[model samples]
Target: MKITLPGSKETLPVGKILCIGRNYAKHAAEMQSDVPGEPMVFLKPSTAIVRSGGVVVLPKQSKDVHHEVELVAVIGKGGRNIPEDEALHHVSAYAAGLDMTARDIQSKAKANRHPWSVAKGFDTFAPLGPLTPADQVGDPQQMEVSVTVNEETRQNGRTADMIFSVAYLVHYTSTIFTLEPGDLIYTGTPDGVGPVEDGDVAEARVSGCAPLRVRMSRELD
Candidate 1:
């Protein structure tokens, strides 16, 4: 799907949605997981994207669905093995995104040591907002990320608490795979993540960027 860039008429052709797991110490502990010594990389296909103001259907495959608010870095330049200092140069914009997951499915996968793709990569699972240009969002590492469900705060965090900074994530990820424009990096979510039922309105926001609002509805057979 195409993404709308703030203040630009052009649309971005989304490639891949790269995600990081357990990137916050407090969040890691809350999830009963350990903080990784390095970046934990994962992939979500572009098909999972639900653009800003879209609805997130509670997939029928799982009983419990959870919301994970995150800060998304939109890559504008492509490169491999990017330098640490030059990593930000590859990012053109930032946005608020949700890494929605099926908690029940994920837990089962973890117990079986199976890949989490089925648990996390469902259609409409990734909700993203309009991209704010990089220059307008200074020092993304200090930005605040938050989420409110049904007008109640569920998650609030500052990028300062991130175990791996945005620049480092970009650089490190580039070493493993080529970073391309429109490839999104979901930095990670904060400590507060919980289940959401149908009809819940979840609003995700990143400091200085547009808010991404989504409503949950069950996928009826």
Candidate 2:
């Protein structure tokens, strides 16, 4: 799928979306999990993306769907085994995004020791905003990221609280998979995650980037 780069006529094709989990200590604690020594990574397919102002069709199989607002790094340059110091140079843009989750399903999967792919890979599971050029987003770690549902704030935290920095995540992930242009890195969420229902409007924001707004609806029979 393709996403339009704001203020420009060009559209960037989306590749794999790599996501970090438990990157925030409080978030990890709130979920009753331990902080990992390293980043816990996962992948979400491109089909899961819903752009700003789009509708998120909550999956019928899930009773508890939660929102996780995140700072997304859009890769501009491709590389393999990139060094941490040079990682930021490969980023083309940044955006505010939501890593929507089927929490009930995820919990079950975790209990069964199964992969979370099905719980996190449904359509409309990922909502993203227009890309803001990296240069315009000054220190990624300093940005404040938040999420609100139906006008009430659900998540509020700063990227500085991340256990794994963006540069480190990039360098580490590249060591496992070849980083390609259009690939996205969803630097995990913070505390205060909760559920959303039909007709709920959720907004995600990252400092210096366009806010991503989306409405939720249950799948029609």
Candidate 3:
């Protein structure tokens, strides 16, 4: 294999992937989900991660799939019970990401009252990339996040619609679990989510942040 670009010695982050769900009421209703009272947090194993411009393999167990474009907050420091006013102090940077879901499995699990791991934690389910240093994101609250599958826009959400703000997310999540260096917080997705087929090229972006894109493939039998 030939390397085209110089690879930096910078080591990739290894930390918790905390994802919030249904923060936008319109998004929840699109799937007929209820508007939750608080942040619906879930974990994506570090192994599920793929960098920007990487391929996202559709899990074998799923049928219907969906993409949830969101704002990603990368933590620079560790702390618990951090106040909302000071939460930004812990942030390292921001980026765009996707909470790719196995919709069929997720719906089934919901009916069975089961945990969301199987539906949300499969390999390549959390696609993120193009790291932007924290100092660069000027206004995290006003960014635009969008997703497109096969050149068709599926989701377009602005951070302003969030019922619970980013500051509150950090303030709340840290109080429960100590957020350490490299911990990533996926704020949540907006409305308008649907499926992608094999060979579909999906592209997502958080305006003024990072770009999130993936090539879809299925494991051959």
Candidate 4:
């Protein structure tokens, strides 16, 4: 099974995963949901990832597929109930990532009050960076995160829009899940979420961080 890639040599640091939902007010409302009073958390099995410059295999179950641009943080150490100022200390690295979603399936599951695992967690659903060490990413709070599909900017946002600061989520999440050295957390996405068709190019960038360019294609029949 030979695969083609631009940055195949890049090795990503692994860790327990945390996903923040409804962190961005515009995104929350676009999905017809309210801004969470607190952080909305979710997870993507690490197995779902396809590193940067890799292909995003569009699933056949796709009624509608969409891309969510997010800021991903890698944890260096495990800590519980950490202080906001202290949150920076736990970060090992950062990367710009895409939380690709099967929107129609997700909506159906939500309507039935079912779990999002099947809808959100699938092979090759999470496409990530070209990692940048924490030292390389300064002021994680003020970076620009943007996503474009087929050369058009679909979603553009800033980390400043996050309802729960990184420190808050790090502290808030540790209390629930025992974070490990290899765990990663996807901070959350902003407004302008939409569909990704096969042959689409999904390019993402984090200001002052590296750029990620991925060309998406449908999975083999």
lDDT of each: 0.93, 0.93, 0.83, 0.81
What lDDT tens digits, residue by residue, belong to model 2 across residues 72-124? 99988899999999999988899999999999999999999999999999998
Which residue runs does candidate 4 get wrong by more than 4 Å?
1-13
RMSD of each: 1.2, 1.3, 3.5, 3.8
Residue-level lDDT for 193 in candidate 2: 92
TM-score of every model?
Answer: 0.97, 0.97, 0.93, 0.91
Candidate 3 stretches greater than 4 Å from native: 1-12
Model 4: which residue pairs collide?
Answer: 14-182, 15-182, 15-183, 16-182, 16-183
Instruction: List pairs with backbone clashes in candidate 1.
Output: none
lDDT of 2 at 54: 97
Candidate 1: where are CA atoms >4 Å away? Answer: 4-10
Q: Is candidate 3 or candidate 4 better by TM-score?
A: 3
Across 82-186, the per-residue lDDT of candidate 1 in tens digits comes to: 999999989989999999999999999999999999999999999988788999999988999999999999999999999999999999999999988789999
What is the C-alpha local distance difference test score of candidate 3?
Answer: 0.83
Question: Which order, best to worst by lDDT?
Answer: 2, 1, 3, 4
Candidate 4 per-residue C-alpha lDDT over 90-123 given as tens digits, one digit per residue, 9 for 90 to 100:
8777889888889999999999999788777877
Count of steric clashes across candidates, in order: 0, 0, 0, 5
**lDDT score, candidate 1:** 0.93
